[model samples]
Target: MQWPDLFDDDNVDDDDLSEMTRKYLPDTVVWTTDWTTGSLIEQLERNVFNVDPPFQRRSAWSDTKASLYIESLLLGCPVPPVTLAELPAQGSEGNFQYVVIDGKQRLTTLKRFALDGELKLTGLKVLRDLNGRSYSEVEQEPEFRRFANLPVRTVVLRNWKKDEVLQFVFHRLNTQTTPLSTHELRRALLAGGFTDYLDRESASSEGLQRILGISEPDYRLRDAELLLRAIAFVRYSNRYKGNLKQFLDTITRSANRSWSEPFARELDEVVGSINSAISAVYDIFDKGAFQRIDDEGQPSGRFNRAVFDILVMTFQNETIRRAATADPQAVRSAFTVVNRNPDFKRFISGTTKTPEAVNGRLRIWWKQLSSALELPYESFEQVQTW
Candidate 1:
């Protein structure tokens, strides 16, 4: 939240520093590009410099989307421009940080296409000519295949000042055209190191969802941001605060390496942890509060907010301490004690617990569970809950 020095020579002039800011473009502007200039990589690397802006989540486009963008660029397709916003300098990392104000999905798609080259596109190509005619007129068109090898058109706003960037981020991210959630922004920005490692290990949402048993994939579940937030909160055990991406990168890098694993193995463990915690949340925390049952056999008025906090605390402790060990029995027994604990209802709701009280409970829970589960975490003590 650092503001640039308006009095600095670079930002203000003696004659016009006092001039009132005015806009002719409603305080926001957007542009387009083809991905041919290799700008996708440039922008992504520029994003690396924008460490604070890591509030945007990690890369989430599927391999197919990447391939499609590549195909579009190669075929001279008219793709939409990438969006940018100029925001004030927050720090050295943000001297010229530009938020991708909009078009993150498209940009991500293009980057993955260039880096991985493993995307699968639907049967469509970008070779439709004027008069709305496709290349259908040419039989066995060799040109279409040739076009598929090219890059995309890229549109970008060059160096913009910070206020304009903030205004742009606010507008595009808040709009209905394809809103980016706080959680998704967390994914884009906060994702690196352990989170990125976790993402790399289990990139597919279907795989993670299948393991968690949360629900079948649908519109709500399809949101990459929701999945990222769930993963990050469970993996790191932190609240979904602003600028989470940057925070995670810094913390996770300093965190114990023992907690991370290859994408497949860690993914399995994360899925298990989230599923168990989520179930515990509903069964012991949410459903515990209600006597009313709907005709569908679901609780009508159950409040499960308490369990969510408990789970967050429990998860967060593990992240800080690297509680997951190499031993399998230890992990199982640790969580089993969590399953048997009975005070989550009072704990998370503040009915009988303050933040201090909650940490005490978690300490006891982890100690007994780790011992019961034979986990390596028995040696790691718990920290304060949020």
Candidate 2:
């Protein structure tokens, strides 16, 4: 992975230089590298450490890969230090936890053995005598002590206040492997209740999966991103302040603050609308509702994000939400209108991340959907809940 170019001092203005320096101001992201496996495991068991940090890749390693890591550990090989980021505490036990920025695969494998006690050491390049032994099966006297004594260098970064800044740094640092999309990065950078909610709630819904033609959740989290796209706008579209991506991130950042009874009710209300929206689309368009145009000018039976966003928001309409199958013909017409409109299609397919494009597509969808569904235009006051 290529690192970002060093700032060009010749071109950097005083303002730019000051901003750069201020970003890394002392104590903003402090670090320490004095931990070992023994201490790390203790913390993990106590729930003081989160092995799977947000923004890091999901735990994709197989037993074979995990075993190789164990072999490396037993051989005292030098693996890279794990990177962690600490956010502002929100006065909860897990709320104050650190997000693992790097070394998630390694750390997760280690934790499986040390804390969960499930990872069995096998396929070793060396230390064959330790083969096929689980952490629990090993004699705790010397073997467990040796495993515990294995050095685990950790660097804790303190006070990264901005979601986008930390997410950018994580995106750069995470390039050691195949890069994740911006949506995937958002999940990590905006580690909190809302992001987690989108993940768990979407992945578990078989109805959503069937409607979208996804047999399972994509590891890239494109499915959850779509769900979040709907929910974000449902909550904040009318009063949207900045860029669309930043607006989504803002929702995620606030989601981490704390969950009250109100948060729960709001979540349920929004999520109910999302489900109803999916039902509405299915009622109108059937299983191929999300199919897209392929390169050969044929409709590919695959889910499309641009289409998904508009449809999801349409269902979010309280009128349509109350009666999705009210006018299947109108729903069909709405879909056709969006696909036929050259400008609407362009807004969705081009510069899709820009505020103008995102907002324009939604507005077009709303206009067409309102006309078709016979629903009154939503007032700005009603659209600012999120």
Local accuracy of candidate 2 as per-residue lDDT tens digits, 1-386: 11122111111112322443456544366677857777876766665555554423345677888988777766667777887787566565546666666666777787898777878877777767777888877655355666667887888878765555555555666556555445665675667777777887777666566754457665556557666767777766664653555666677777778656789678888888788777777777775575544445444565566666666766666666554487786766666667667777676554555567667877876777777766677642244455
Q: Please give the lDDT score for candidate 2.
A: 0.64
- Give per-candidate clash totals: 37, 3
Badly placed stretches (over 4 Å) of model 2 are: 1-35, 46-48, 52-59, 86-97, 122-131, 139-153, 180-200, 207-226, 253-258, 291-297, 300-302, 318-337, 369-386
For model 1 the TM-score comes to: 0.40
Candidate 1's C-alpha runs over 4 A off are 1-75, 85-101, 111-115, 120-122, 125-174, 190-276, 282-297, 300-307, 310-386
Q: In candidate 1, what are the lDDT values of residues 88-151, reduced to their tens digit?
A: 5678665655555456666655444433333334434453331122323222456444454445
Error of 1 at 149 (Å): 12
RMSD per candidate (Å) reads 13.4, 7.3
Model 2: per-residue Cα lDDT at residue 174: 57
